[model samples]
Target chain A: EAGVTQSPTHLIKTRGQQATLRCSPISGHTSVYWYQQALGLGLQFLLWYDEGEERNRGNFPPRFSGRQFPNYSSELNVNALELEDSALYLCASSRRGNLNYGYTFGSGTRLTVV
Target chain B: QKEVEQDPGPLSVPEGAIVSLNCTYSNSAFQYFMWYRQYSRKGPELLMYTYSSGNKEDGRFTAQVDKSSKYISLFIRDSQPSDSATYLCAMNGVGYGQNFVFGPGTRLSVLP
Candidate 1:
């Protein structure tokens, strides 16, 4: 099994610019989730997508948005990025309608806003 | 108050010592509890998962969940240096697309 995979392991972006992070879920997984892990803040939920639909989102602002493709891959986009957006963005995946097994997480994209 | 609470300890222990990590959650609706081990720069890997209450054992690791007390625990026996990492506790309810609440994580270091 390939597990979850994320692209652009490290990214640096200027303040006020936009950033895009990508994720590919494991084979046979249909649900994708995005989270932000800031220093000492733990994991903050960002968004959740299932079967190509945005199921729910966290308390994040509208600037933090993302979409899941038909293939179950996901892309997180941050517009008007602030220095606070520089935390590591993680993606996780799980089988459809399954929560007992827990989600499989990717290594995450380290986004640095300068 | 946060949904889940854990002591953010950078606990140091001997290589062969027994390690105990714990988390307390404010939400009694959370039925599934889990433990994840994460390296400094890597993503978290699920170590154990337990439903409702009771204990589950896997080799050198054990996960205990007490729904009545809203507390959960992870025990590592004969800890090795390779076990040095941050341990995270998470839980969620029966919803299909619900987000699993996570703790701040406890950093563990097994000294050789």
Candidate 2:
């Protein structure tokens, strides 16, 4: 089966600008989760969306927000970006109740904020 | 302390050598344990997943979880240079704590 797919493999944005990252889950998956992997810092959970609703989020600021589309795709929006915001943003999708082996992830979108 | 902690080892080992990686977690409620291998600039690929405590083996890789000690381990046998990458340990609880928590990752380098 085709794995998760993400758009704009690389992005370069200015400080204070906005960054938008997109993700398409597997064909039958319905839950999408966003994670930021900055240098030195590991996978920091950003947001979790299930069935078109935001289920949970990490300790990140409100500027880091996202939504899941009807088709189970997701978009992450980072507003007022800062240098530290530069990182690889990954999106994973899982079957609603099958959280075990369903966390199929995409390669990720590398965001570079100057 | 972080929920999950691992040694960020840039460990170098010759090919054919056995490799061992470990992680400790602060939360005892986590029942799902996983090991992920990630290459540079790439996303992580899940290597093993075990529920609760026990050992699960897949080819050259093995995953062991010890809930009493809140520790887990991954062992790679007859390692090759292709085995070189960052290994991350992740966990999740049932119901309210289903979110996956990850470690800082341990970088392994298998020299040819």
Candidate 3:
């Protein structure tokens, strides 16, 4: 079984520019989650999408947003990126309605805001 | 205070030594606990999961959760150099769409 997959292994964007990251969940998975892992800071949840609907989000600002497609793939958009926005953005997938089971994570997209 | 607190240890140990990692959470509602091992430049892989409290052992790994103290622990017996990585502890409540709170992670290096 293929695990979660993320595109653009590494991305470099200038300040004030926009960046987009993509993720593809595993087969038969319906829930996709986005997280940011900054240096020294642990994994911080960004967004949660299930069945193409945004279910929950973290304390991040509105500039950090994303959506899930019908096929359970997801896209995370960071608008007006700042130097603080540089981090490894990870995508995870799990079976819908199963909170007890842990998620499977992708290698992550390393975003560097210059 | 943060919801979960873990010592960010760059702990070095001998290959055959026992390794112990722990995390303490402030939220009492968090019922599900998990430990993940992440390699350099790679995403975290779930190592163990437990609900509420008690101990679960898998091979050389053992996970323990104490609901009263809101503490969780992971133990590795006879560790190997392959276990060198960051171990992260995550937890969440019972809600379906609930998000997990993760620790800063402890970096472990086992020398062969």
Candidate 4:
């Protein structure tokens, strides 16, 4: 089976601009998750979407929002981006809402906010 | 303290050596443990996942979880240079859609 896939492997934006990253979950997966990996930092949870509904989110600001499409693909929007927003944004998917089911992550999009 | 704490080790070891990586979590409710291996500039790949306190062996990799101490470990036997990568430990509670808390990755370098 094809694994999780992400689009626009890299993105370049400036402060005050908006950055959008996209991800397509593995086929038959219903849960999509977003994470941020800043330099020298661990993966930070951004958002979670299951069955086209927002399930939960991390401590990130409101400007960081996203939605899951009907096909189970997801998009992450970082508005009013700052230099610190320059990081690898990762997307993952699970077959179900349970975390015990494990997750499959995409290669991620490298966002360079200049 | 962070929910999950891990040593950010640029651990360098010789090939064929036994390598150990670990993480400690503050949340005792986390019943599921996972380890992910990430290459430079790449996303994390699931290495091993365990549901409880026990040892699960797969090939040369073994994962052990100690619920009493809130400690989890990954052991790589007969390690190879290709094993060089960042290893991240993640855990989740029993609630529906519990967030997976990840630790600062431990960087490992297996030199041939």
- Candidate 4 ranges with C-alpha deviation above 4 Å: A98-101
For model 2, the stretches where C-alpha displacement exceeds 4 angstroms are B95-97
lDDT of 3 by residue, B1-112 (tens): 9989998999999999999999998888899899999999999999999998999999999999999998999999999999999999999885634678899999999999
Q: What is the C-alpha RMSD of each candidate to the true structure, in Å?
A: 1.0, 1.0, 1.0, 1.1
Model 1: runs farther than 4 Å from truth?
B94-96
Q: What is the DockQ of candidate 4?
A: 0.75
Candidate 1 residue-wise lDDT, A21-99, digit = tens: 9999999999999999999999999999999999999999999998999888999999999999989899999987787
Using lDDT, give the best candidate's number: 3
Q: After superposition, how far is residue A81 of candidate 2 from its true place, in Å?
A: 0.6
For each candidate, give its TM-score against the true structure: 0.98, 0.98, 0.98, 0.97
Indicate the residue-level lDDT of A16 in model 1: 97
Worst 10 residues of 3 chain A by lDDT: A94-103
Cα error, candidate 2, residue B11 (Å):
0.8
Interface RMSD of each: 0.7, 1.3, 0.9, 1.4
The whole-model lDDT of each prediction reads 0.94, 0.92, 0.94, 0.92
Candidate 2 vs candidate 4: the DockQ winner is 4
